[model samples]
Structure formats: C-alpha cells, structure tokens
Target: MGNGDNCNPNWKDASFSYYKYVPSLAAAGIFTGFFFLAFAGHSFRMIKARAWFLIEVLGFAGRAVSANQEPGCWTQPPYLVQTLFILLAPALFAASVYMTLGRIIEVVDGEKYAIIKRRWLTKIFVCGDIVCFLLLGGGGGMLASAKTNKSAFDLGNNIIIGGLVLQLLWFGLFVVITLLFHRRMMLSPTARSYQPDIKWRSYLHALYVASALIIVRNIFRLIEYCQGSNGYLMTTEVFVYCLDALPMFLVVAWFLWKYPGEISGLLRRKELYDGSMHEI
Candidate 1:
C-alpha cells in the first residue's frame, strides 16, 4: 500500500487491513460467551450474587469493544456514548475485583489471616471505586461533549488521570494485603486450615491474575490519557489491544474457565467458615 492508500477511507481490496482488528473482535466474542456462561451459572444459582455483578460488567466491557472500533466512523453522539461506556466499564470491573477479593478474604479468615478487617474490605475499596468511576465518566463525558474544545479535553483527560491514580493506589494497597495474608497463611496452621479446598485456592489465584491484569491495564490507560488524545498511544491500535483488550479478555476468560460458581459452592460445602465467622 502507498502513503495515499494509508490515508484512504475506503478501498476495494482491504481484506488484509481487517486482520488487524481480529483481536478486538475476538475479545468481544470471547467475553460474549463468558457472559452467557455467567448467566447460565447465575440462573442455576451456581454463582453468587457478587459473581453475577462481575459477569454483567463483563458484558458491558465486551460491548465497549464494538463501540470503540472505528471511532472515526461514528457520528458525534454515537462516539460520545461509546467513549462514556468504554471508560466507565473497566472502572466498574476494577470495583468488582474489590468485591471478589473481599469475598475471598472472608473465606481466608479475614480478621485472623488478613492485614485489615474483613468488614472494611468492600466498604473502603468499593466506595473508592465509585469515586473513581464518577471522575472517569464525568471527565470522559466532558471531553466527548466538548468536541473541538482543546482546553476542555485536556481538563477531562486530567480528571481521568486523577481517577486512574486513585485506582492504582488502592490496587497497590490490596497487593500488600494479599502478600501479608499469604505469608500469614503459610506460617499459621490455623489460617491454612481455614483454606477451603484446592479448587478454592485456584479460584483465588484466578482472582489474583484478574486483579493484576486490570491494574496493569489501568496503569497503561493512565499513561495513555496523560499523553492526551493527540498522543501516539491514543492513535495506535496495537497498544489498545495488547495493553487493554487482551488483559480484560484474559481476566474474564480465566474466571470462566476456572468456574468461580463451582469453586464457591465447593468452599461453601467444605464449611470453611463456622457460624462464628464475621460476615463481610
């Protein structure tokens, strides 16, 4: 293809160009399947209410991929709507991660094994998540609505960065908590005894992978937005697919493969928590 061909909006033979977008489309399709699995699992009461929320958010994220594709082709209104949903969806997933981790910590013996109180796990992290979501959504909406207003776009991106930073900080703290809990579990027989079953540990490991993937994606987003809309990262497809889309696809896919509903059921049946355990 010539330089002019690169700038062409339409072409008779563009089959090769379509291959570049397969990753995004594949991610969308995979998550669509994951959504159905989540629904089926939840409908049969195999998964808990918390897991249902995770599945619903994955559906939104999967839809965002479709919305995000060919942004240049979308009209102003459609583009704005897409931007809002795409930015908002992942933040919600990060929030759901907090909820997932909270539930896992409860199973792990929150007060005894974890560094922090179990009661505050969801409260603090999820509330922080809400604040981050509002900032990102509000800022994204402002930028999308601003059209050609450069200053407003910059302000909006800055707001998004602020939200991303907060999320990073929260994830960092949670990582520390996870490490401490793991260490305690290894050292204390009581904490290890509270461990549900092998499958439950695998479920927790899946969550750890999910959390790490989301955190990495958030960091990339933070850097991308910090560079502004005109930056290379914003204009590139590879970065978006590798840094953002791939991580999310893996997170949901991993969870679906591990089948959290079954694992949680096993944990419940194992009776890891006596009646005296504090409710999260």
Candidate 2:
C-alpha cells in the first residue's frame, strides 16, 4: 500500500510533465505546417497563393507554444514574440482567404460574378493585409515588451485594437462585395452558365465557412486585446481556447482538409481553354 503512491506520478507531476512537453508538441505542429506548405508547393505549383495560409498555421503553432511556456509573462521578449505571432498570423489567414476568393472570381469569369476586376482583387486585399500585419505586429511587440506602467501597455493594446478594427473593416467590405457579387450572379441572365460544378461548389462553401470562422475569431481577438492585460479575457485561459484557438483551428483544419491545391489545379486546367480564367 505504501508503494502505491510511487507506482504512478501524482496529478500535479503529470501536469508538469505535460506542460514541459508542450513546446515540443508545438514544434511538431509547426513542422506539420511546413510539411503541408511543401506538399502544396510540390503538388500544385501554386505556392505563391498558398503561402499566407502556411504562414498562419506556423504562426498559430508558434503562438500555442509561447502561451504554454509563459502563461502570463508580460514584459518579456518571449511575450512579444508570442503576441506578434498570434496577432499577425490571423491577418495572413485573412489574406489567404481574400486571395482564394479573388481567384475564385477569376475562375468563374469576372464579367458575371465579380464586381471588381479579377486582376484587382489580390492587389487590393493583399495590400490591405500588409498594412494590418505591420500595425498588429508593431503594436503587439511594444505591448508585450512594455515594462513601464499601465499607460504604456495600454498604448500598445490600443494600437493592436486599431489594427484589428481596420482588419474587420476590410473584411466587412470584402464580405459585402462577395454577397453583392453572389446576388448579382443569381439575378443575372447568365446565372445558369456561371454555376460551378459540384466539387467547385463544395470548395466555395468551404471558403465561406472558413471566412466566417476567421471573422468570428478576429472579433474575439479584437475584444480581448481591447480589454488590456488585466481584463477578463486576458486572465482567462478558457476564453482564449474557446474564442481564439478554437475558431482558428477549425478554419485551418477545414481548409487543410479541403486542400486548396485541388481547386487551384482545376483553375489551372480551365485557364488553358478559357481566356477569362487567369493563371493562378
């Protein structure tokens, strides 16, 4: 009976062991993302289009490890890196979403389905994404590294909120355009001609779900950062897991499961015959 306790580790010790292994687990996740990136590049040859998604996945993996290692290590360089990776990573996912949507528009023929010219979709949304990334990255770095009083931290948090708000605005516009385009197509004479095949339609639905998931996640993040470090959202791990981590994981998993490479391959094939379908 006395040796029973020694037969197995206590709960606390088991937890510590799990915690200690988290960084290695996170590294494995990052490696998985890199492997997927290479897979997409090798299989589809559309590496340029898939780059943002890979970045986002790797970023999320990095953020997860950082969070586990330093639950609340503010004022530390690791904190800054963690915040930057998590904060900026989603913006990259959004960029990938935008690129995918734009390319879809091109695939369907811009004249009937898209409002903006196909050529302009990537240019506009990606440029906006770049701006958001800079703002969030800069702001998160400052906030995490701030050793000063509350005001300095608040300043950094505010800047992050600003960037997030800007992203929401940009995404809102994109959604509006997408809806309007869909509506326009539904009402047009060429509606029947524009309907995608079953596989393509499935891809479109996947994108829609992915976009909605990301937008919801971003909203949570915007609120979390706006609350500052001492805020309820920041102090609570549950909220972070449910709101931030869950949504992103769902979105990324959905897309990865769908594998955009298949869609891109179709687009490439179509582009050979259709003058309107631009090269991916």
Clashing pairs in 1: none
Error of 2 at 148 (Å): 2.0
For 110-185, candidate 1 gives per-residue lDDT tens digits of 4578667778877888888899889988888787676557688678878989988988898888778877876776
Residue range 1-280, candidate 2, lDDT tens digits: 1123222243223311111112334543654465456446444544544334344445445445544542222123433454576567678778878887776665566455677777887799999999999888877777755644567667877888999999999989888887777666556624323545525455567777887887898899988777655557665556755676667767766776775545575577666756654543
TM-score of every candidate relative to the true structure: 0.73, 0.73
Give candidate 2's error at residue 80 in angstroms.
2.6
Ten-residue stretch with the least lDDT total in model 1: 11-20
Give the true-structure RMSD of model 1.
Answer: 7.0
Q: Candidate 2 — what's its lDDT?
A: 0.63
